[model samples]
Target chain A: MNAIEIKNLNKSYQNGLKALENINLSVKKGEIFALLGPNGAGKSTLINIICGITKKSSGQIRVFGRDNEADYKKTRSMIGLVPQEIATDSFERVINTLRFSRGLFNKPSSDRYLDSVLNSLELSHKKSNQIRTLSGGMKRRVMIAKALSHEPNILFLDEPTAGVDVALRKTLWSYLNNLKKQGVTIFLTTHYIEEAENIADRIGVINNGKIIIIEYKKKLLKKFGEKKLIFTINRKNKSINTINSIIKKYELKQKGNKITFNYTQNSKKDPASDLLSELNKRSIRFQDLEIKKNNLEEIFINLVQK
Target chain B: MNIRGIKAIYNFEMSRTFRTITQSIASPVLSTILYFIVFGSAIGSRINDIDGLNYSSFLVPGLVMLTILNQSISNSSFGIYFPKFSGTIYEILSAPISPFEITCGYVLAAASKSVLVGIIILATSSFFIELSIIHPFWMIFLLILISLTFSLFGFIIGIWADDFQKIQLIPSFIITPLTFLGGSFYSINMLPEFWQKVSYFNPIVYLVSAFRWSFYGNSDVNIKISIFAIFFFLGLCLVLISMIFRSGYKIKT
Candidate 1:
């Protein structure tokens, strides 16, 4: 059975704004699924609904095969959520916050486990300090520590590394990877495509309150990833007509003396040798040659735009 | 509400309240001293006796209740409102803590503050006037019950309010006026016949009269009626608060 199942999920605000429309997805256990989207793409809304923080306008949700509405307590205990905002009670100490969070999940207090969590998050030294006195990055770490205190099987991180510095982001990613290795299912939402590309086994792109696509990271990249080869030649070349005819024969675009060839990596036929041989046969000399492969950012933009 | 969750929430809330001990304790103490100087000494000089007791003595129970009521309202409102304003409420909501546990934690913390302030005011009043508790157990019981009732009311207000201005609306517009007109400083008998009839409508009057009866064995309203009124208001506040929690009103989308 899937770790989480969302069926025809829908959410609308009281002001008559529909934030999510018919979202349906299932996450298997022990997998890292990244939900990628732009601002206001309903990523946070979806997380809130599954975490039982927000009421759904319609549809059904289950966690560990338990219905969220009917067995909210059981479902809630199985998941830990780190929200998008940097939220912490500033007056409480770090250790106290973690303890409270653990207890909230009905987990009995264990100093040994709590200490390990604090040590792993590098929050041991700041345990007794007030949260208000901690730096921003430290506070964010405290939030992660709090979420992990209960040893939940499933963890949800909503824009977890947003606004974090490079070093901290790298450390957090490594820590999350370690957690994943320990058999925890991580469901994350992030604006940083690189984070998703680095960590996710599967990627789900959401745009305008709809899930545009959900596919294995490798398969998605292979299917939608576009690469282009560009050739810049002498602008004053007199054999432009001959070049245009040759380019047309090879199905390439020629503007002035410059030519660009677009192709997918998964194409059965290799166009590189053919293009080079054709250029040589036609005696076409290019000033510069460049090949560009589309990154996750480009893929995301293209899907969102669509 | 989960028992463990409630305990966690209660501890978290109590720790936060204790962190601001100076503000929580000093404000009520200072306010009570000022009340004694202005109303007890200055005003009592001319008013003489009220309800067969010295003006200063008559004002003790009312003043203590006022302090408790104000602290209860401010503490509870600020307790919940700050979390909302700072966005920490989202963290709490996301955690496994249920809404019922959250409500109880905040209301109980506020009630604890109110009880502490009540005790302080009662202790300080002894320096200014010869105060005696006609029924010690009743006084303590009524003080706790009143504080809990007001704290719960404040919890509802905090949940319903969106901004700082909205949080202050109840204290400024509703609580302050009701407190002043509830026969805190003077008896309802002093008011004109028509206004006396109107004073009966004020719910705070029942709380104040009940508290006074606990102290002096004298009450402006019947003792049984006052107790009934206190329970009725307490019950009403509890029901409203429970409904707000169950519906996730103002806390959820």
Candidate 2:
């Protein structure tokens, strides 16, 4: 069964701003789905609506084939959310807060499970310490622990690394991977392209409240990433108009003496060698050449720009 | 139905109160004691009797009711507003718990603290004043009712307020001044007819009068009207809170 399915989702704020329009998505069980977007691109709104923290203007959302609203307790119990903010200010000990969060779902007390969560998150040593005294990173971990305490099968981390340091980001990356290894389905939203590129099995690009692209990470990379060959020919008496016309059919860019042409690597034929041979036939000499492929960052920018 | 959810929230809020015991409980009780010192001792000498009760003794119910109003609104408002400000309210909103369950947890904890402080001040006031009670059951009922009602009102204020300064706005500007003029320290009969009629407009006057009536079996207004006034405010607060949850005001989206 799919972990979550949202169809025809629409959210219009009372101020007449339409935050999301016609969003449909299906996240498979045990797969890490990354919703990539710019700020205010409806990423947080989508997650909030799914978790029932915000109301949707209209939509159908089902978790594991059951209506999300109809079975709020059952659906919410199956999911956990780590919000974007480091909002843990409860003056209680870390362990008590975790226990209390677990009990909020009516889960029976199990010290073993609690200890393991604490230990995995490296929070066991601070179990007895009050939450207000902990550092920022530790407080974020406690937020994650609170989300995990109830043992939800699906976890949503909203911009988990927004303001965190690189070291803590790495730690969280590995921790999330470990959770995925244990067969938990994870859904995370991030504005960082590399973050989604590194951890997501599937990446969905959202722009201006619309899902512009959603595909397997590898497929998206293969489709969007194309190789480009640029020739830095010696500045000479070559007719610029002729050169441009010669390569008019090929997707190309020209700046001074350097001319670049892009070709799909997966294409049946190599366009670079043909272009080079074509240049040679025209007696156009090149001083140097280099090949470039569209990285995930480039692809992300192109998609968002569109 | 969300008993576990209610317990977790209740426990968390209650622990916070315990942690800030000096601020939440001690400060107000200590302040009430100072009021007892100045008003009870210094003022009692000038006016020996009012409403057929000694001035010092007459101040008991009024002082307790005043403490209840101040602390109940302050505690409950700060309790809920802090979570909203820190963004931890998302946890409560996202949980499987219903809005009613959340209300029960926060409002009950606030009421408990205010009522506890009220009782403690009354205990402290007994050492200085010669106390008398005509209707003990009625007194206890009025005490619990006021705390619960005002705590709920504070909850509404907490939700309505979005900023740090706004949390203190109602309590400092509206409540404190109204309580002072609500016949807490003196009988309205001592005021001229115009001022007495003005005192009747203050909602807190009904609470203090009914509480004093339980002690001396004498009230400025009819006792039934006082009970009705409390319930009326309680119902209004409850309705406002219910609307807040139902419409997701300042909370959901």
Candidate 3:
């Protein structure tokens, strides 16, 4: 069964703003799904709805085939959420906060489990430290530790590494991957595409309160990922007229010294190879040649812009 | 019922109380003792006995009730308000715990602390004044009821308040004054016939009267009306809390 299934989810604020519309999604158990969106794209709203923090205006949500609202106690107990904001009881000790979270989720006290979680996060030494005494990055890690204290099957991280340093972010990503290997289903929303690229098995793009695409990370890269071929001609002004026919035929873009052609990975024809051989046949000398494949960031930008 | 969840919140709140022991326990207890020294001695020296009871002894129940009302509201208000203010409320709201369980956790903790303070005040008051409870069971019952009622009211205030000023607004401007004028130190019969009728308008008068009845059995108003008033206020707070949770008031969304 899917870990989370959202059907026709809609949320409208009292201020007449529509936050989410017709959101239909399902996250398979034991998979890592990353949600990518710009600010105010309803990513957090969707997570909040599923977590039962924000009440949905209309729709049905099911967790493991049980209705989320009707079986909220069971559903919420199974899911853990690390919110975007680093808000915790500053006066509370790190260990006490985790204990409180576990108890709040109706989990039995397991100091061994909590200590393991802290050790994994490298927070064992700071267990007795008050949250306010920790650095910003340490505090973020504390939030993650608190979320995992209940040993939930499903975890939702909303922009987990928004302002975190690169080193801590990488550490967190590795920890999340470790959680995934334990058969935990992870759902995360992030503006950092690199984090998603490195960790997410599937990616969902949301724009303007609507989901534009949801596909396997590999499939998305193959489908929308573009490969650009650039050729730097030996003499641009002299070769322009000679290569004008070829450039027009292949729809290439000409700059001061180079002509570039773009194609997707799944293209039927080998346009880059054909263009190279065609240029050689015509004896068009070039100084440099380069092929570049677009990463998830570029594809994400294109999709959102569209 | 999510008993563990309720316990987690209850323990969290109680720990906070102990952590700030000076403000939570010492301050109130000391203030109540000071009230005894000033009001009990200074004023008791001037006034004769009313209804055949010494002025200091007569002031015991009213003093305890005053402490319960103030402490209950302050404790419960700060308990919920700090969470909402700090953004930690998301954990509580998103947890498996129901609204009823959440209310029980906070209200019970607040009432427990208030009752402890009331008991402490009674213990200390015995050192100075000759005191007796005409109905010990009724006194205990009224103590718990008043604490729960005011704690619920304070929970509403915590949810309603957006800033610290608003949190202090009701207790300082409304509740404290009402308690002082509600006959905490003096019986309403001492006032003129018109003033006695006016005192009925203050709900604190009913609470004080009923609580005092449990002590000297010298109630200024009927016990039944006071009982009804307590339940009515408790019900109103409950209804408002239900509405707040339903509407996702300040705590959610």
Q: What's the best-to-worst order under lDDT?
A: 3, 2, 1
TM-score of 1: 0.92
Candidate 2: segments with Cα more than 4 A from true spot: A90-92, A229-261, A267-293
Which pairs of residues collide in model 1?
none
Q: B134 in model 1: Cα distance from truth in Å?
A: 2.0
lDDT of 2 by residue, A128-193 (tens): 999988988898899999999999999999998887889989899899999999989999999777
**Model 2's DockQ?**
0.61
- What does candidate 1's lDDT look like per residue over A1-306, in tens digits? 899999999999879899999999999899999999999999999999998889999999999999987888888888988988888887788888889889888889887898999999998999899999999999888988988999988999999999999899999899989999999999999999999999999999999899999999988888888878889976656687778787787688777657888877666766766787887787778899999888889999989987
Candidates 2 and 3, the one with greater TM-score: 3
| Fnat for each predicted structure, in order | 0.72, 0.72, 0.85
Candidate topping lDDT: 3
**Higher-scoring candidate on lDDT, 1 or 2:** 2
Please write out the lDDT profile of model 3 over residues A100-191, one tens digit for every residue: 99999999999999999999999999999999999999999999998999999999999999899999999999999899999999999999
Model 2 steric clash pairs? none
Residue B122 of model 2 has an lDDT of: 78
Q: Give the chain A TM-score for each candidate.
A: 0.92, 0.89, 0.96
What lDDT does candidate 1 reach at residue B235? 93
Clashes of 1: 0
DockQ scores of the candidates: 0.59, 0.61, 0.84
